[model samples]
Target: MRQKEIQLNSDELRSYIDSVGYEKDNLLEQLRKETQDLGDESIMQVGSSQGKLLEIICRIGNFNKCIELGVFTGYSSICIAKGINDEGRLFAIDISEKYTSIAKKYWEKSGLDHKITLILDEAINVLDTFIDDGLKGTFDFIFIDADKSNYIEYYKKSFDLIRSGGIIAIDNTIWKGKVFDNDDQTQSTKTIRDLNMLISNDPMVSQCIITMYDGMTLCLKK
Candidate 1:
């Protein structure tokens, strides 16, 4: 018989996974605590396991050029920067100086300030600028976790910016499991659902949705 997929249905299971899935970084732990102090907004920060996964993906792919559309408190940025070589660079784009201010502090604490360049602008503007600058197909990896309504647009520009064989990792694809609720019809849910449908049928890329955290879709340009 085929084995059934395991579900992290209980706090015990989740705690177990958190314990052994990846080694904990003290700096990240501290970052998590500090972010939590921000109250509800801390929810925007990626979970530790997800951050670790991002680091591993960057390291395994040996990706040098990276782009992150959302740099909340810099946990994920630091993780990505750590995975890259000394000379690798990550262009972290965010519109909020308030939140990114926190990220800057951690980036410095992690000694990854040189590897990350923070861009304070609308994500679309930066993406378009890259395309207009004739930088198409130059990025090795792109991570999108910004505004839900602009996800489709971000994916389009990210596809253009990413080279063949590059990976574009999109977070919140599951949108807290709302994508499957046909009646929701909210703009954000509809957009994510539509993007999932688009990628599932598209032949230009191979994709899989990892049901971790809010759910992340990793698409490899082919």
Candidate 2:
């Protein structure tokens, strides 16, 4: 294949298709637009375009089980739930009942309310409970976009919950490029940078730090 052709992204390909008056072009574009409107403005919220790509990946994986460490306003949850849900189950943990109720509306609207199981509590506590209940290596996918300070803790728990050949994605792992910036040595950046190095050298999974919206470390469990 030619270099230019190989360089085209999913978005560029979609745009090219729309230019040719493809039948599904309008609907696809609309989906992109609408998702952004409902999504929150938090640093934690993955953008609509990226979220759409992730949702499609989850759908195609047909993963039966997923665990999400954070459910900030439910944008990412909605994206993941839309993908894998005939017999699938999503275990999402977050402490905010108020934010979750807002996400509940979208889940019901998408008719994916049953696909997700929202747990309102601390992540460490919930994960420990899952471990105690013999849920080791049960999940096919796990996403960690929560408290940055406890990233390593989440990584360890996710490693145990995810089955072999499963994928684990950690958001803000690059900390908006701040991990490399030595402007501050505060605990947050230090923790993230420390984990970045730690995971790079971890033997349990092969990691790729993709330079997406933020730096996303996508790990495939070995």
Model number with the top lDDT: 1
- lDDT (tens digit, per residue) of candidate 2 on 49-101: 55665577687777779988888667778778877868888898898886677
* TM-score between model 1 and native: 0.96
Clashing pairs for predicted structure model 2, backbone only: none
Off by over 4 Å in 2: 1-41
Superposed Cα deviation of residue 144, candidate 2 (Å)? 0.2
lDDT of each: 0.93, 0.78
lDDT measured at residue 140 in model 1 versus the true structure, 0 to 100: 93
TM-score per candidate: 0.96, 0.81
Residue 39, candidate 2: how far off, in angstroms?
12
Give the C-alpha lDDT of model 1. 0.93
